[model samples]
Target chain A: MFFHKYKYGLLQTIRNKELTFWALGFTIILGTLFYAAFGNVYENDDIFEAIPVAVVENVGDDGFMQLLTELSQGEDKMLVVNKTDREKAEELLGNGDVEAIITVDESIALSINSTSDSISVSIVGSIVNEYNTKSALFEEIAKTNPEKLPQAIEAMNVNIDNVIKEHKLTDAPMNPYTDYFYNLIAMGILFGSTFGMTIAINSQGNLSAIAARKCVSPAKKSMSAIADILAAVTIVFACSVITILYVKYVLGVELGDRLGMYILTALFGSIMSVSLGYAVGSVGSIGEKAKGAILLTVTLLGGFLSGLMSHGMRQIVESKVPFINRVNPAAILTDAFFSLTVYPHYDRYIRSIIGMAVITVICTVAGIIMTRRKKYASL
Target chain B: MQAFNLAFKILKKNLGAVCMYFGIFFTMVILMTKFNPTDAFTTTKLTIAVRDLDNTTASQMLVEWIGENHDVAEADFDNEDEMLASLYYKEYDYAITIDKGFSEKLANGETDGLFTVSTSPVSYTTAFFDSQLSSFVSNVNCYVAGGFDVDEAVSKTAQSVTAAADINSLDGNEESPDAFEYYRFLGFVLVVIMISALSAVLMTMFKKEVLARTYCSTVSDTKYVMQVILACSVIALGIWLFIVAVSMVFDPQTVFSRTGVLIIINSFVYMIITVEISVVIALLVKNRSAVDMCSNVIGLGMGFLCGVFVPSFMMDESVLMVGKFLPAFWYNRALEIATSSYEQIYNAKDFATCIGVQLLFIVTLMAAILVVIRSKRQQKSL
Candidate 1:
């Protein structure tokens, strides 16, 4: 009897339209939002653009061209400004048009002139500052000892010679792209639909209340458990597919890595949500309170832990309880996307699949235990 | 006053939903601040490429000192051009090239060598390299003064000094933090976006089945409109204060004092913007689902484009320019200037420009709302 009621409850939820609409709507909205939110830190634009520095050389020697050539490469975009002389370079620096100006003194040591106000430019100035340091040291040593100048210049020449031979490495990660909203939408649709479906289950099949009524007639316990699990899984999978499709098509959020992983992760995530819903629905006397509490908890907890709340709160969580980042299913899902995109070798993706799977099982068992414990009052 | 009384009555009648609305907004505030960490720790030796010209004992000692103190990345630079190229591009912060006169110059009792560091982290990077250079130079001077072997004396005299900041203030709370940009004022933006949406969603749910009966009869349209505006304004102001206060709770610097006053003003401007959005949802969309959909369209959509949910850097130039037109973006800009020392670069007067733009949006949106409401009433009367 319990088996029939549980099985029937799952089918009725499948036929519900209102819940389906919300699930899809949320999935699209959340997915798009999520896709935009994460991956933003890395602005994927052209690389190798040099900080535009105005050069003012009293010598006008061709040697400086080598420095300019090495820095700018074939890209004219890097060194956007090359003033004719010091006066122009200084003018541009004073006006803030140029980030920094490199003025070479008669002695070969360089000096960087810029309004000290800009920290980023000042840092750029430091690199220029080093060139001055080199020239000054070279001039001072050669003038005093003369012998060391040839050797030092020779070493510098050799270092320059090796530039092409030596490999330059940049380990900047690939765009750690993710959308908070997409994940939120995906999780919310799964969770919200399942929560909504609990209402459907009660309205359609008074499964728990009717279970005890039929207990006297006769029903196997194992069959009852199977029915409940099957119903919840069916509801989870159906809602997940509709919501996932809406998330993909309408919102245009990037779905990374294996499509199978996304479905699998969301499935377990939904099972947990519904299992919690079932546990709450098992509150016999006042179902509304249970429903409200369950919905509120799912949305708030999911939002808070997963950084759906805001950057400020996310910062606080990361600083104070960084581990909350690990446990959050929404965080797990989003991180998995990032890992696949950025850290192809990162362990987080594997962890997400395993963690969510474990959670699904736990939720399923809890839902079964709570829903089937035979509401003492109903008995 | 009558409008306010009506609004108060409506709100009083619906407290549970109001809390839920407030709860989500508050949670957004908490989440935004929590996401970024304020940590100050030393990273293990950042690889530094060295091109020793002299290769003398003094030069070797200088290189050895660098290896001991910092992770000196052994990079081969056959020439000055290669080293300069790498430093300019940030492959290395500072590079050392020992000039030819090193042994003779040191023997001559003059401390002269060149240390080059980029301008990017001029403060931290310059200070660090400066200290190391000073120590190495002083050791060379000592050896020259006393005819000492460079390596043995330099290593023996070198002291490992660690820097510690006395951040425990009189107020007991630390001001700002190390790596101020790391938290990336962008977090605050995410908080405001989520808050506006959450508040809108929660507020939407307040339009229950029975409000239609009250909305249709007895209450004059003037009273109804006035009451709604009043209720929204009050709720909006209340939410604004709560958000600002919560913002103040973290980032105590620039968040309080005269800056806090600026935040208080901008908070109203922003919350009013949010409340107007919420009001539109309540007036038009009766269904919870519809309300949520509309709110997401305006709140989330605008937030996405306007540098709230995502930083403007990630946005396309055209999209970012469009985002500049939104009141929320300007409002946050006002808050940003008020709360950070960026006010030093672009002061309060500049921030007022953003405020001016935001006001323009409020007026425009309010005007649109008024026009819609007036047209709806005329249609009903006809």
Candidate 2:
């Protein structure tokens, strides 16, 4: 009987070409998107390449010219493009060609007339971040007396390690590629609920269909509701399976926890998501407006709590109104994934289970009530 | 006229469904608009620690000053080990420790005030914490001199001065972004979303028996096709305006002069492209589920891929090239440029290209759907 009902549902869904195309398209696009998004595409290193710089030696000093030559030919440096033209430098900013440009004047240190302190501050701050190197040999000589010159040379080289140490900060390693599985959780909920609601509404409303046939027979309303729920659950289950399999096998998304927890989240998530569809449609007055409002609200709120948007928004939300964070499904799913990555404890893990359960109960009850409501008109 | 008559019936019958969709759009508009665009660039989780062992009045005042400022709002551990542990664990941003001789050294006008602040030297956010330290220093320097003027020489040569960076940033020709630009984006998003939903609605309305029956009737096929487009447009435009009005409530800084006329014209062009996309979906798919499923994949997925979800600027180089091909991408790109510093660069030529691309997609997709409809799927119902 279950197999027969399943076949009927399949036949009913596939008869529509648009629906089939969407199913296939998501399997391709989202499959690829999730695959690509979940994949580790970027592996960042601290090496600089293609540094943009401009040179102008107005003082005509051999030492300054030598410094410029060394900068241009430095092996560790990536100055492939020497943008000496001011017009070209300004154009580069608009074209998104480079993050910044370093323009060197001949009297770079001494010439007060040509200086724009504001431009220097902005330019130098950016330069320090990218280059992470600083040298002022002449300034050091000008400040101190001439008598202790030989000894001071030895002392200056002694403090060279401090200059090297400043740049050394870039090397001490940690995972620079931030994990974004919270986004996956948000996608799952959005996909599951949208898919579930559509199928559930159609399955239930067309009582002349298989579900209605079951309702008229020895099968009770509860049994029929259960069957519909099961069908919806199957949809979410398939969706999660697709997500996990694609995310893990194809996309190489880190599931942090073992497959067991991933499976658990999917099941609980699917159940809640499917029930939400029934709850929405069962209200006897569920319109496209309400569904849209709920879906968008859930997507944004869920996506936000999962740290999908700007980090500031996420931090402010988490550190401030932590209570809302507790109820948010995106936060719960994120916390579950975060649990596997950050902590092995089940405290947050159990909270996800509890939250899914509450959503399940609420949605299930709403569905039951809607199914029990009398239809005033039929097509 | 027949299309309009039947369109009203379809809309009235699906009143519940229509209202739900509108509700969702309005809700999203409200949420997106309420967030302050000003604070989007502000850095997060900044913390400062003042380890004053002597605990004098001056020390307390310095500590209190840090406490009052929102920049150092989350200051944590008082002890060295505690602060270090938190810093390592990434709890606090940075730690500033003032030694016992800090007050005495500063009061004497001596340059030997030994204050050391430890930060994860690698963290890019260290500069943010360092800026707070500069503010503290300049304030103290002025306090000692019986005036608030920080010595100009020290200010110029200092490797890290907060006021210096602030002034530098101010000197640049920073454009003030109007809220209407964001609203225009919201308008584009709504147009696409509604189109997607309508595609699904069209597919679901299809039934095999109904299609076969329609084939046996005397109704002109082109007229029926026209009805679908007409109905979808009427409904979609309603959605577009409702979203616009709802979105506008959150942004009252309306530039309501002649520019409002320009905005209206842009909205008209955008709506035309939306109708075309909707028509393409209507003709391409016949099942309800397929309409929705395909619409989402095309609408939401492409919307994101085409740089709808996150701005295209933050996107990596490789994906950005692919994004340029999408119609929605051009729609957003044009919208962004029109409302940004690129107003001069985004001349009439580029604007024409963006509008041209969307129109081309609509025309091309519609033609393809028509060919498919006539050759194989003629026995259809709408």
Candidate 3:
């Protein structure tokens, strides 16, 4: 009997095309937009190619030539030197073929077309500056102690390595771009709240005409509520899963490797969202439009707190008033995904799942308690 | 005048919907202003964890150097997995391990293979570190090849790479002190589109259901249509004024500034265009649910493609091509001009062109709506 009721409830929800569109279609559209906007951002940041430099060898200095050869002839080459005369180098700069022209005479000098900041040009300029300073230093050192040059070179390399080593600390990579997708999934789940809200409205005797008709039936109010909520959850869960699959496979977003964990988070997230909606619907005496306003405020505010607006908001909340993360359903859903993908352990993920489950139970119980004892004045 | 009064009464009754419009705009403004994009790059500092497995003089020196700009911390962990766990939880932004004989390898002047690491590549620290390493290595390699003594090369290479040029801006004074441009576009577009569209749908829908009752009344059809439009326009105007007032509260100087006044005028023009489009949408869409769906699609789809949420430069060429047909594209173009410093004669011309294009869209959509409504009325009379 419960299965038949649940099946009928599911069909009613599917028939309501506008509600289904908001819960499912709108989410897919927004998800695709997010994917398009932030997809290539991280990959482009991590890769680099050899910087092209126009080197004008005016004096044919053997030492400088050897240095250029050594730096430019390997797999991880610093530069791709374009050996040219002064005239051609100037033309190359004009045509934008090279970043900067290095005039290798007594002192290394850089010539370029404009001061418009280009990373490659800045690098070339720095290289030229370093070489000139080194040339002056080497001249002084050769004069002071000609035999000590070889040992001096080794010492300089060690010091240089030490200097560069200070800032290059890195190990476990985290892509900042993936946070958008995580927040998007969180949003899709929270949208399930709207379904819960409408279900609660339609099932409560006083709130809706349909619920008033059902109230006259032989089945218990709590039993009907359960069946209705179950049907709504099933529909919402399916939509959320489809959104996840679309994002992961169709959009090609890397949503971690653990499919089981993703499914678990989505399930719990949908249940919590629906219960919240149901509670809001049952507890309030307001109309459908008013209930919708409340749902929008709660979900959008929750999304904002969970870093839907900007990526750093989550970190800010975590650092200050972290209890908000513990309570905000949207934040919890996002954190579950964050833990699965970014964290090395399941501790945070488990905590989020448990938190969602607790909220769901509380909301569902409160909703039932509020609606179970109904004395309808109308219908 | 009677029709006008009745329409105004109806609008007053539905002020709840107007508040929903205000709520959306308020949320958007607050979100855009509070969570600044620049904070990620400018304000935050990277925390680096050093795992000096070598424990040599070279490794220690490397760690010390990394400490110069970054907040260096010791990675107190049992093994690689534990160290990575710290990194994953954002305990440290970066982690590095200096290999054994790193000093010996460097002193011997090897081209590569000194360390292993992972880092937040997007951060300014990574770029600074990368360039510094390249410059230093090249200098050392040159000094050695030039026959400089070991002690002299170390001192000279360190002194050689000191930054020679300080960056100076060409148009530094022209730049706005606070980025008001980024904050303005979303609210104006969202509020105008949502309120005007919803009002038209609701009013037209109400009139359709009570067409026979409305005919029984004294007011003529033309006067009744005009009054309904006038009421919606008044409501749209109220929303526009509210937004302008709010913007003034946040940035009084910008709101009263000459450019701010120009932007306000530009927004008003676009608001009218949106109203006309909304009226046309009411004529086309039959049901309330369809109206809601239409509003959402138009609001979000046009908002994105027309550079309401995303900047115009970020949008693809194909998307922009489609967006050109919409009034919002022109609206954003005019906004772009208004927000930017009016330094050139071309800016004034571009502003006029954008406003002109918006007016053209309004005329076209209004014409279409009138034709459709006339045919429907004729069919009803038959």
Candidate 4:
């Protein structure tokens, strides 16, 4: 009887177009939109590129020109120098072609446009200051300590590139913007709570004619309810798997190499979402629409606080009200995925999984307690 | 008049959702204003974490120099994982560790392997910090070669590196930057609330059973449609007025300025465009869930693509090419022009072009709605 009910429950859920659309179709569409929206956001905006600068040589200082040539000569070159006249340089600056212009005269001077890139302008300013300061050091040394002038000049020519070593702690992809996609998947699974609400509404005898008939039937109500919830969880888990695969394969999002763990977390989160909805639905005899609204509020508000709309919102919430992260299912789910991708170990990921499990058990227990041995006053 | 009244009655039922959307908009605006108070051009100051292992005067001076320029947050440098987590969460921009022999290497004029740094992949701030650190070490090397001790060399390099170049601003106008951000984000809020609320009302009024009952009345079809359209316009106008009044309270200076007036006119035009889009969506979708789906997809899709969440300049050219077809893009473009800094002279022609494009979208969406409605009427006749 349990198997029969579970098979029929699966068929009923598949036939429900609204539930399927929210669970599967909406995720696919939103994922595609996210792909289109975040194109090259990290590569174009956050990464450093060579600063474009124009040089206006007033007195034709060989030393400054040599320095410019050296700085602009490598693959990881600092500056893309455009040697030109004052008028041409000013034109480049006005057109935003160059970040700043260097006037190589008695003293190095920089002229930058107000709308120039701040980082590029600062780099160029630092280069000029370094040059002027070194020039002053050399002049002072030549006058005060002529014996050490050669040594000082040689020291100034030392290659400073190897002075600092860049250490990478992990080989994981560090684009923070990818957190949006993780949150998107969590949101998709959280919407499955509506299906859970439907399960609760369908089992209550007062809610529908079919349910009222079932109440009078010989089948045990507990067995049927369990079968219905299991069926709903199966459907939601299937949809989440499809979304995770689509996000990974089609969208080409880097969700880490732990594909099995991701699917596992999605399955766990699916159960939690459906259980939450079941709990909310069983608590009150309110209209299904109101219960659905409550579920949506929980889902969207959780997503918002976990950085669905704004990147870094989760960090803000973590700093301001840490308890929210500890309780928010969406945050926990997203963190599970984030930890899987970023951390080298499974400690944080395990904690998030435990959080999902605790929520699921608590909600499932509350739902059972609410619906058990209840009699309608008038049905 | 009955159709119009019924449309409003349906809207009254959905007032709770509408108010929730408005509440969301207000919260977002307030949060944005509070968090991002300044949008003016300023030098970027990176948050760096440093652990000095050398304990030498030269290493201490280097750490202090970095502290002077950037925000150096204290961290347990012995733990690499905690620092990596900080960098991942963006709490600290870069983490640096001075090697044990940093001062000894510099004193010997050996510039290599003095410090180790960790950063997120492809970070611009890390590169900038690298340049500044290299320059500092080279300046110290120059003094070391000039016969100064390690301590004196470090001090001399510090004083010499402070000689900064002159920076000038060509910005012509000193308009408040916050006004631009407020209006720019308004594009997203407007699209969302207008579509969700207006579509809810129109969907109810255009439901098959309700429309069938309405057709049995004595009212003319064209007159009924016109009255419903007028009702939608009034609702849209009310939402617009409330939003504008809220803006006036938050930023009275921009609301009363000339640019503020232009921004208001621009937003009003965009509101009409959104209403027409909502009508088109309502006519196409079958149910409320479909309406919700369209609202999220269209609202968030446009918000991300049209420079509402991400600035226009930072987005790729290809992505922006697609955004150009959307009305929100033009709306943001106009806001950017109106509140632009002094360097880019605000052109009336450009602002007018943005408004003109939005008007074109209105006309196009209007035609689409008419086509959908006509097809529906034909189906009914069949």
In terms of DockQ, the best-performing candidate is 4
Q: Candidate 2, residues B1-382: lDDT per residue as tens digits? A: 5544655665566565456545654555445455534312121335565556647666565665555442453444444433433443455555665567655654543333345566664343454344344434433433333321223222322332222211122114334244444544544355546555565445433445544565566756666657766777677777767655653554444435333433444565666666666656666665555555655566555555655554555455566577666666766656654544322243667766776776786677667767866765555432
| Second chain alone, TM-score for each candidate | 0.53, 0.69, 0.75, 0.90
Ranking of predictions according to lDDT? 4, 3, 1, 2
lDDT of 3 at B7: 59
Query: DockQ of all candidates, in order?
Result: 0.06, 0.10, 0.19, 0.57
Superior candidate under TM-score, 2 versus 3: 3
- Per-candidate Cα lDDT values, in order, are 0.51, 0.50, 0.68, 0.84
TM-score of chain B of 2: 0.69
Error of 4 at A273 (Å): 2.2
Least lDDT summed over 10 consecutive residues: which range in candidate 4 chain B? B169-178
Expressed as tens digits, the lDDT of each residue in B310-332 for candidate 4 is: 77777777878989989999998
Best by lDDT: 4
Q: Model 1, range A136-224, lDDT digits (tens) per residue?
A: 44554556656555554543433221111122222223221333444554465345435433643343224545444545545554465
**lDDT digits (tens) for residues A195-297 of candidate 2:** 5455555545453364454434654455445555576566557656666666666655555546777777777777876677667655554665577468657
TM-score of every candidate: 0.62, 0.63, 0.77, 0.93
Identify the candidate with maximal TM-score.
4
> Given candidate 2, what's the lDDT at residue B361?
69
Write down the worst ten-residue block by lDDT for model 2 chain A.
A159-168
Off by over 4 Å in 3: A43-150, A153-174, A284-290, A343-345, A373-379, B5-93, B96-116, B120-128, B133-206, B209-214, B231-269, B286-293, B333-360
How far residue B287's Cα lies from its native spot in candidate 1, in Å, is 3.7
- Model 2 TM-score (2 dp): 0.63
**Model 3 Cα lDDT, one tens digit per residue, B1-382:** 7655665665566555566656776766566667444211121245787677777654565566556545876675445544543454455766766667655654566646555666654443455456555666556555555564334444455655553522222223243313254344542455345444445444553565566677788877777767766766676677667767777887777768877777778777877776766676667776666666666667666676666776665556667787798788788777767766222222788989998998888788778878987998899789
